[model samples]
Target: MADDSKSGGDLEKDQRSQEDAPPSSIYLISYPKIVFLYPTFLVAVVVAIFMSIAGESAQIGGNREHMAEVMSLIFLGVFGLNLTVLAFDFPRTTSLTLFFLGAALFMGAWMLLRFNPDIVPTITGLLKGLRPWANSQMYWLFASILGLIFIGVAISVRFDYWEVKGNELLHHHGFLSDLERFAAPNLKIDKEISDIFEYLLLRSGRLVLHPRNQPRAIVLDNVPFISRKEKQITRMLGALQVQVRPDNH
Candidate 1:
C-alpha cells in the first residue's frame, strides 16, 4: 500500500513538472539590413557608365561631340578596381574600400601627370565634365529612382523577418501581418557562403531550414553573425527537446 501511494505521489510530481515546463524561447533572426546600399551602388554604376561615355564622346549643346579616350581609360580603371572588391569579403559599409581606392587612384594620377606633362590637355578635358553640362537633368532622373528604391526597401524591411520557435519556423511578412509557420522538429539547418564578398563585408551568409514535412526548404539570405545564430538555435532546440520528452519512469 505504501509503495502504491509513493508511486502515485511520484506520478503526480512528474505530471506537474511536465505541465509547468516553460515554452522554449522564440528566436528572432533578421537580414543584415543593408538595403540602403542598393541606391548607393546604383548611383556608383551610373556614374561609372557616364564617365566612360564622357570619355568616349565629349558633348556640347545638343549635337556637338568629339572623341575623348582619356575619360574612358580612367573609367575602365575605376571599374576594374571596383571589381576586385568582389574578390574579398567586405565589411558592412564600403567606406574603407572606397577610401583606399580613391587614395590609390589619386596617387596613380599624380604620378602619371608628373611623369608625362604632355597628357595634361587630355586630363584637363576630362576634368571639364565635372563642370555644369547640358542634359544634366539625367542625373536628377537617376537620383529620383534611387530615392524611390531607398524608400521602398526601408518600408518593407520592417515587415519582413524570420523567427524560430522550438516547434516551428515562422516568417512574419507583408504589411498585413501575414505569418507563415513551418514545422521545425527534425529541421535541418544549412549555412551557405553565398558570396565571399558579402561574407567579408558583414560576416553574413545564407541560412536555410529543411522541415521534415515540407518538400521545399525555406531560405534566409544575408543573415549577419550567422555563426552565433546557428549555435543559439542548436542550443535552444536541444533544450526544447529535453523539456518535451516523457519521463522514463
Candidate 2:
C-alpha cells in the first residue's frame, strides 16, 4: 500500500511538470496574395463538375442550357469580384461592408431590370445575348492551373518561415535550409491588419518583430491567425522574462 501511494504521488508530479512545460517553438508562415484566389479555384471545380454531369445527359436539353447560362454568369461574377478584391484594398471593416452593400444593390437593380425586359428592351436584348458559356474542359483546365499554383505556394512557404523559441528567433529559408538567428529576449512585436478582406479570408495580418540590437524591424505579411500567434509569443517571452529576472531579498 505504501508503494502504491508513492507511485501515485510520482505520477501526479510528472503530470504537473508536463502541464507547466512551455512550447518548444512557434513557426510563422506568410502566404502570398494569390492564396486568396481559392474561391475562384473552388468555383471552377464545382462548375466543371456540373458541366460534366450536364454534358453526359442528352435528354435534358432545355434544362442543361438554362443551367449552363446560370453557371456561366456565376463564374464570371465570382472571377470579376475576386479580381476586384485583389486589385483594391479594404483597410477598414466599414469600407468593406459598404463595398459589399453597394455591389448587392447594383446586382439587385440589374436583376430587376433583367426580369422586366419591357423596361429597357435594348439593354435586355444585349443582356440576353451575353451567355458566356464554355466547355467543361475549359473549367477543368482553369481548376488544374489554380491547383498547381496553390500546391507551389504551399511548398514554397515551407522553405521560408520564421521560428520563435524562448531565447532566439530563427529564419529558415532557401532550398539548402539556410538559417538566421536573432535574440528573442526583449523582442517587440506589433500586429497590423491592413486589409480587412484578407483578414476575413484567412485571419491574416502583418507581424512586425523588433529583435534586440536590430536597427530595422522584420515585417512578415499575410500571416494567418495573427492574434493567436501574438498571444503565444507573448506568453513564451513573458515566461522567459519571469524566469530570468533577478530575485530581490
Candidate 3:
C-alpha cells in the first residue's frame, strides 16, 4: 500500500510538470494602422490648388481658349484628393485613385498648353518666373487644398485601429458608433523583403482565416511593422497550443 501511495504522488508531480512546461510555438497576428507623411500630402495639395486658381482665372479672363487649362487644373485638384487618401495606406483603393488622378492631370495639362499660348507663358512664368505673386492663385489654391487633405488624412489615422490577443483579432474603424469586428482564425503569415516602390513604400503582407468552414481566405495588405507582430502572434498561438497552417486560397 505504501509503495502504491508513493507511485500515485509521483504521477501527480509528473502531471503538474507537464502542465507547467512552456509552449512549443506561438503565432502573433496584428495589422498596424497606416501612417502618412503629412509633408508630402501638403506639397501635393499646394500644387493642386495653384493649378485650380490658374484654371479659374483663365476662365474668367474671357480667354475662351484657356477653358481647357481651367478644366485641367480642376482635374489636378481631384488627383490631389485621391493621393492624400492613398498616402493613408488604402491599398485596395490606391490603384483606382491613381488612375483617375493621372488621367485628369494628363488631359488637363495637355489641353492648357495646346489651347492658349499667351496664358501658357503667363502661367509658366508664374510657375517659373520667380515673382512672389507670379502664381499667387495657384499658391493659395495649393495651401487650401493641402489643409483639407490633412484634415481628411488625420481623420483616417485617428479612427483606424487593430490588435490581436490569443485567438481573437480586433478592429475598430469609422467614427463613434460605427465599429467593425473581424476574427482571424487559422492565421497564416508570410514575410518578404521586396520593393513595393523602391522603398518609398514598404508592404508587410498577411493572410487570415475566414473562421468559416468554407474554403476561403481573407487577405490583409500593406501591413507596416510586421516582424514584431509576427513574434507576438506566434507566442500567443504557442501558449494556446493551437495548430496554424498556411492558407493558400
Cα RMSD to native, each candidate? 12.8, 3.4, 14.5
Q: Evaluate model 1: give its TM-score.
A: 0.50
Cα lDDT of model 2 overall? Answer: 0.88
| Rank order (by TM-score, best first) | 2, 1, 3
Superposed Cα deviation of residue 123, candidate 1 (Å): 6.9
Q: Per-prediction count of colliding residue pairs?
A: 4, 0, 14
Compare the candidates by TM-score and give the number of the best one: 2
Error of 3 at 198 (Å): 7.2
Q: How accurate is candidate 1 locally (lDDT)?
A: 0.64
Across 1-249, the per-residue lDDT of candidate 2 in tens digits comes to: 999999999999999978766677999998888998989999999999988987733333654456666777899999988887788888895766888899899998798886787898888788777866677888999999999999999999999999998699999999999999999999999999888888888899999999999999999998999988998899889899998999997
Q: Kindly list the per-residue Cα lDDT of model 3 for residues 1-249, writing each as its tens digit.
A: 999999999999999978764444333333332233344444545555555555534444653444435444554565565455555433443555775788899889868866765676877666443322224455456556766765765566556655565456555566773654445455555554232331244335443435434355545544555555556666665655445554577
Higher-TM-score candidate of 1 and 2:
2
lDDT (Cα atoms) of all candidates against the true structure: 0.64, 0.88, 0.52
Report the lDDT of model 1 for residue 14. Answer: 100
- Residues 1-249, model 1: lDDT tens digits: 999999999999999977655445544445534442443455445654665566434654553643233433443454455455544455446646766898999999988876775788788567555433323244445456656776776576779887887687888888899999887767788888655555655666878888778888878877777876787788667776787899999
